[model samples]
Target: MRARALVPGVPALLPSYASLDDPVAPLRAACLSAVGELGPRVRVVASGPSGRRVGAALAEAVGAVVVDADETGTLVVGNGSATRTEKAPGHLDERAAGFDAALRASFDHIDLALADELWADVTCLVGLPPLADGDVRYDDAPYGVQYWVAVWG
Candidate 1:
């Protein structure tokens, strides 16, 4: 139960979305490094099926098995606002930056309604300890989607 990690459930991280040039190379490396630290058993918490798939792939990539209970580590998949820019998946939302800023400060209080409007998958993000208690390996909005790769050990 010591290991904990959070990675955005971006399709770009999945093999199915892999490109010959590898658009998300740095993100993949950060995810692998973080997921590698989780022991042999990992409990994955994701907002939806797609996120679950991403978590499963990451855990398997590191030789870890996804377990339902009694896991040695936990992988929570989620992300902040996706409407950060004009090219964002959900398109630009004027409230996105402020929303993401609040999230960065604390996951303690989240505007679920606004999150949905901004296309943020934060259902699994609630109740986590805090990013301040861990190391944030990656935090950027590449492709206009806010993604974070963090681990707590």
Candidate 2:
């Protein structure tokens, strides 16, 4: 099934790991930004001017190995599986007790601006990896808003 078909309805809280304070990037790099392997449920983050470059960077990052990443887009590389919940921290912390702690840990210090439904957090790609699940790759230029991603270890 198309990963987007399995979009989760529960409200999610992990905002992009990137921030506006990011150094200005060149246009060509932004045009080819990689969206990475979000697995089954790819939340297409609409990265603005730097969309292409960010996506390309993310795609390369996805191709590389990632660890302790419970938020941002969970890339399912190689043969691995993870359990995810509506709460982001719970998914990361080995000892997360409930939703509140999870939320605090996940969104702590992260800047959040209200985006349309298009900006909702992505969830539950499970065993799918970008190498195998390329659906998360958006070949086109970003609509404008690129995502800031962070891997909380």
Candidate 3:
């Protein structure tokens, strides 16, 4: 399976929800660039309908099509935590940084309880193929949210 990309489920990534001056312009650019590499037919894996919409918007931005079957590549949408700082979406949680750090190291074993408390959206990440150091295209905690955009062939 050619897994093309991994993006965060950030609502701001969607054009419909975009602001006059995008707060995540750089992040959006990165996401589009990554999605463009996924070829024409892409399969989207997300936690819910909202996430699916974000994925679809991203695919559209890159002139890619979201497919349910016979996809050329897979796009997994998820993120680490929303409670990394005081101004974070979920506000600061003492355990947020550690949880996100562990996820960055490896998405294999996760603490469900901690994830919930930290407002992490990692359900779609579990059991996914491992990402190599070189495969990581974007890795940061911008806006106190841990987001990654990695690709694998």
The candidate 1 region of ten consecutive residues with least summed lDDT is 125-134
What's the CA error at residue 128 for candidate 3, in Å? 2.4
TM-score against native, each model: 0.97, 0.20, 0.94
Model 2, position 39: C-alpha lDDT score = 39
User: What TM-score does candidate 2 reach?
Assistant: 0.20
Q: Whose lDDT is higher: candidate 1's or candidate 2's?
A: 1
Model 3 TM-score is 0.94
Quantify all predictions' global Cα lDDT against the true fold: 0.91, 0.27, 0.86
Task: Give residue 146's error in model 1 in angstroms.
Answer: 0.5
What digit string (tens of lDDT, one per residue) describes model 1 on residues 107-134?
8889999999999999988987778888
Best candidate according to TM-score: 1
Q: Please state the error at residue 22 of candidate 3 in Å.
A: 1.5
Q: Which candidate ranks first by lDDT, i.e. highest?
A: 1
lDDT of 2 by residue, 40-152 (tens): 22333322323323333444443533233333443221101112233332233332223223322343322222211223232222222322223222111122222222221
Which pairs clash (backbone N, Cα, C closer than 3 Å) in model 3?
Answer: none
Model 1, residue 27: distance off in Å is 0.9
Q: Candidate 2: worst 10 consecutive residues by lDDT?
A: 5-14
Comparing 1 with 3 on lDDT, the higher-scoring candidate is 1
